[model samples]
Target: MNVTFRCPPELEQVLPRPVPAKVGLPDWLRRMPATAHDEVLGVELMTVKKCAPFLDAMGYGFLMPLACDLQIDKGRLSWDWDLPATPGETYSRSPVALHAAAQVRGSPFEKGAAPMLKFNAFWTIELPAGWSLLCTHPVNRTDLPFRSLTGMVDSDRYTDNFINFVAEWIDPSFSGILPRGTPVAQCIPVRRESFDYRFEVMTQDETDAFRDTRDSMDGTAGVYRRDMRVRK
Candidate 1:
């Protein structure tokens, strides 16, 4: 999946040196220090399968609830998942916008309740200079999928709130799925040393967690159906 962001013009002028015009996580990470976790506020990207597991590993499962909040807060962005009527077509879609509802089944908590997480919207944001950072880990079909979630705060308070949300609430609720150990490979910084700029701090992993989830649903009757709404 690809996460795209429109950098504010004012802030865009002060971007850090671009990482050697190459594509890949190492090149991207080497360009910026993992310590630059402070200058990010919001992110916009296509959701990928690998990201789900990475988030779970990082103890970020709590954001599942916030996924719904972001939808209401950020609103939806125009895009397409390119999923077709069949499973083969579904995998063909690249950089798809994944909704929070797709991740959880039935009610978020109850047996028949609707999903509490809803992330259909693309993200948009405005923050103080050096206050927020956005990143994207474009997926390579042959390589392990690389995805990202931007950090949007200057203080630990925001990070702490996120951590607490994951640890105290999300973790307990989804304990069965979360893997042991920290999920994130590292938290990097965004810098502006030259005219060229880069804005992304990525957290990466090797497993195809998202793909695995979707694959697991394969052959399971009534698993990948699209939703239908009845208007009054």
Candidate 2:
């Protein structure tokens, strides 16, 4: 699915600033030297696209966090993989490690019909300092077609646990209803095959508006699109 980000001028002013800093103390400290930064900056804008099947294979459903982790410096965009050095190796870049840190913050389990699940996954993209924007998407798919007893998570809320639940659901191994020991590669068989799926983006403001409408008592009449195939 191809997802894009559009930031409004007002919101773009709140982004964090990234700066290079030292990571080691004096000789007495006896610690290895490294580099650390609190945030990423110098990002004017960003655009990202992820294949649905590939993302399912990678055990994730969303790339917002991953896209956020990307940093643009000068003219090149770089992803900072905060990795630890091995005994012999000087450095390493693990996408998994970077992913683990990009999770949202909050519980997924609410007090209603929609149950919640959690998984460990995260991604981020760095923009220029003091950059904030009202992000919106041209297309947004709140409802995706899949067969399972498990209820879908609320995508409107960008909580950590919520994001994790989405990841594990698409992951074959972690799927609560699936047989144990299923290889991650085989999780989304339908997605693996030639299946048609679409993705779109919703700006932060737009998402808020949708949620507001959905939250209203009169809004219980929800809408969904379904395309099912049955074998005889």
**lDDT by residue (tens digit), candidate 2, 9-30:** 3323432221111111113223
- Against the hidden reference, what TM-scores do the models get? 0.19, 0.18
lDDT of 1 by residue, 1-232 (tens): 1112332233233322122112223333335332322336453332332233332323211111112111111222233222224333212122224334434454333323322321221222223344433322222211211123333334212332221111101222221221111122222234323587788643344246556556766634334333222211
**Count of clashes in candidate 2:** 29
TM-score, model 1 to reference: 0.19
Per-model root-mean-square deviation over C-alphas? 24.7, 24.3
Q: Tell me how far the alpha carbon of residue 210 in candidate 1 is from the true structure, in angstroms, after superposition.
A: 42
Q: Which candidate is the best by TM-score?
A: 1
Q: Give the Cα error of residue 193 in candidate 2, in Å.
A: 45
Query: Model 1: residues >4 Å from true position, as ranges?
Result: 1-152, 156-160, 163-178, 182-186, 191-232
